[model samples]
Target chain A: MECTDFKLIVVGGSAGSFSVVSHLLAGLRPDFKLPIVLSLHRLKHVRSGLVEGLSLKSKLRVIEPNDKEKLQQNTVYLAPANYHLFVELDGTVALSTEESHNHSRPSIDHTLGSAAYAYRDKLLGILLTGANRDGAAGMKEIADNKGFTIVQDPLSCDIDTMPKEALKLFRPDRLMNPEDILHFLNALPG
Target chain B: MQNSEKDYNYKEYLLILKECSPYDFSEYSDNSIDRRIKKIMRDQGLNMEELVLKTRTEPDFVEQVVEAITVNTTELFRDPDVWNHILKKVLPALKHQKKINIWHAGCSTGQEVYSLLILLDHLQILDRAEIYATDISKKALEQAKKGQYFYNFNAEKYRENFKASFEGETVPDFDSYFSADADKDLLKIRTDFSEKVQFIKHDLVKGDLPFYNKFDLIFCRNVLIYFQGSLQSKIVERFHENLFPGGTMILGSHESLGGFFKTKFSKNGPVYHRTNSFHFKY
Candidate 1:
């Protein structure tokens, strides 16, 4: 599917998904103007390292935002460990320590739900391979709100539980492999 | 253009909230507050005009609004290891003191305060402990003071959390804390457990701490992560000044002291010890 006109891109993943994320980030143009927010499941106790890890491979600037930091174009923002990240109606970031939903902080459901509310049809939501079902309901929310939604092809995932769960919840606008998603993001108007 | 419109709506709503309630949310992180307000609006199916009008005209409507915006999520024996650390290393050091002054800042619904109290009671030190629990949300403080919770306490989660608190120690009976109410819809902690706790309504972000020069231990968990970086540092400084020399402060598992306060306290997982006397550096 060829798509554009999105203001924000949200990506959620868990176990065995980092390599796909890294590959996708490496392929995106350095000047890609849409703000991309990532909500990868992380160890709740440790801080740091993850952003640095992603930044090493990403062409775009990678950052972990402080509470209330404004979303900026061409930057990749990762949710900090142990805090649930949210998007505000005015397009800034909010962090919450509310009880872990689906047994994970930075749960995909919370982030995507907020983004779906804030950006509506202007959001592109992507769910990748994960061991848990955290992103299923969130992807559903995005699709329900008229935002474009995509899931990594379950047959190709190292772990299919997450994408399979999303498939069970709602039909996504596109089902892709890592390379297709990379090209899709790169093809968006800069 | 869309962003500007949302920004205008957000600021106006916050102004309405400030005028209608005792708390000022203006200084709290803006995006967090805005998202929460939007969540409330979405849940209630109300537009900004409806929300503002209801907030102005409806009595106790503002309370529900405040509760919705404020982060009150907590659990019994949260991060049990922190409690274990306090019980093992911190409390014995204060055992000889004739009086213990403890403050649980942003003590949402009072679970951490009561957890500490239960530990003190187990150690047979409750008689000398003076506990102060404070939160910015009056609704939360009211629930805390009432100590009655609908939706029965989860004994299994409680047991699991307690088991994780200590290494190889026999688990305490979690059932002892809660008894069913007449309707069987709620589980209320025995009133005697909270008899010594003094619940106060205080804002940690915009206002001065309610007390000065008296706390031996302070528990301000999960609350700091909600704030912006500067506010976190400021509140940590206030915590330092409030704590007695050699006293201990416990932050949430995810939070830590920033800047120079990092030097003022020695850290142990989630616990920090005030080293020597502190002088607030302007």
Candidate 2:
């Protein structure tokens, strides 16, 4: 799929995501204009300071979004702990706990599926190192919507189950290592 | 009236609520609604019988009941762990952004907004950020704009929350957070931070969004539960439209968007993002 109009980039992971995200952000330029949404499965009971921890490594603006909060370009949005985050049709960020899917409040499928529905052909869904099959159907949904889909090369993934599962469900447009993924992302016209 | 009569009357009272209030308590979890009504009745010094009878006749009584039913109990930094998380995980990511816009919905009495301002100040990024605090209640917005609170009310709680969430060794003095008059109207924020936040009266239910400015972060905690499913979805969709491509959205600890919108975000913890639609698989 051509990613010409794809402005939103969703990255989903769970176990061993910190290193992967760091690598991805480190590879991108500081002035990268695309919006990046990170959905990391976290313990519902613990305080997840993923945004603050990741902020130290990247030059982009990182934040925990609020209700009715508008989305901006070139920022990193971290899902708050114990809440499911969704993108509103208007392209703003919304948080909810209305219910749990995949037994996770901030389910990767929920986020990826929503974006696929909202952005259609312009969406790019990425599933990286993760433990569960949370993102399998979501990757398919992105493809079904004619949006671009990418999975971390399972051989290189810390936990290969998620990317492997996604690959089984659908053939993604790109399957590359972290370094190559960066080159691929940088090559995209914003 | 018999006990059964009282039960029927209670159901009728709830029906009246459905007719008058925007929220339909009929479909709300029964135990929760019962608990709220019981608390309202007890607080108003009225037994169930009296409450039912009085509510039927008093025109303004429904408004009181509406107020009692709505969830208005919010404190500054209501959840310190979340604040701690933001401090440790979120703010440092945006150090390079030239300007930041933060929307604080349900910013009742401005405590949360001040708490945020303090957080930004501590990070030394207060000058680069703009805060928009909006709420449906005019009275709450006015109080937030005033930026004052009573010392004896919940001052201790605020201080404790702040201390617990703060990352620095020398916690900023609470006095620095606010100023006070002889009458005890403790203005919780300095003018600079206060000025940075633009206060507007917005009804998330009916009216249009106030500003056209796209925000970097939006904090809408504990506001959508009051709305019905459709309204909640509509508002969430509106929020999506208001944001720039990579902005963040934060919700209350207990809230989620399961029934409302699609999730295109990478979950960090409490915050979500509208992934830049520009990044497609090459």
Identify the leading candidate in terms of lDDT. Answer: 1
> Worst lDDT window (10 residues) for model 1 chain B?
B150-159
Query: Counting only residues 3 or more apart in sequence or on different chains, how many pairs clash (N, Cα, C under 3 Å) in candidate 2?
Result: 65
Candidate 2 DockQ vs. native? 0.02
Docking class of 1: acceptable
Give candidate 2 regions above 4 Å deviation: A1-190, B1-63, B168-170, B180-187, B226-231, B259-262, B277-282
lDDT of 1: 0.83
| Per-residue alpha-carbon lDDT of candidate 2 for residues A58-153, written as tens digits (9 for 90 to 100) | 878888776546678889888776566776567866565434567676888878887786678878778898888887888899899898988999
**Native contacts kept, each candidate:** 0.48, 0.00
Interface RMSD of each: 3.8, 8.2
For model 1, what is the error of residue B152's alpha carbon versus the real structure, in angstroms, after optimal superposition? 5.2
Top of the candidates by DockQ:
1
lDDT score of model 2? 0.74
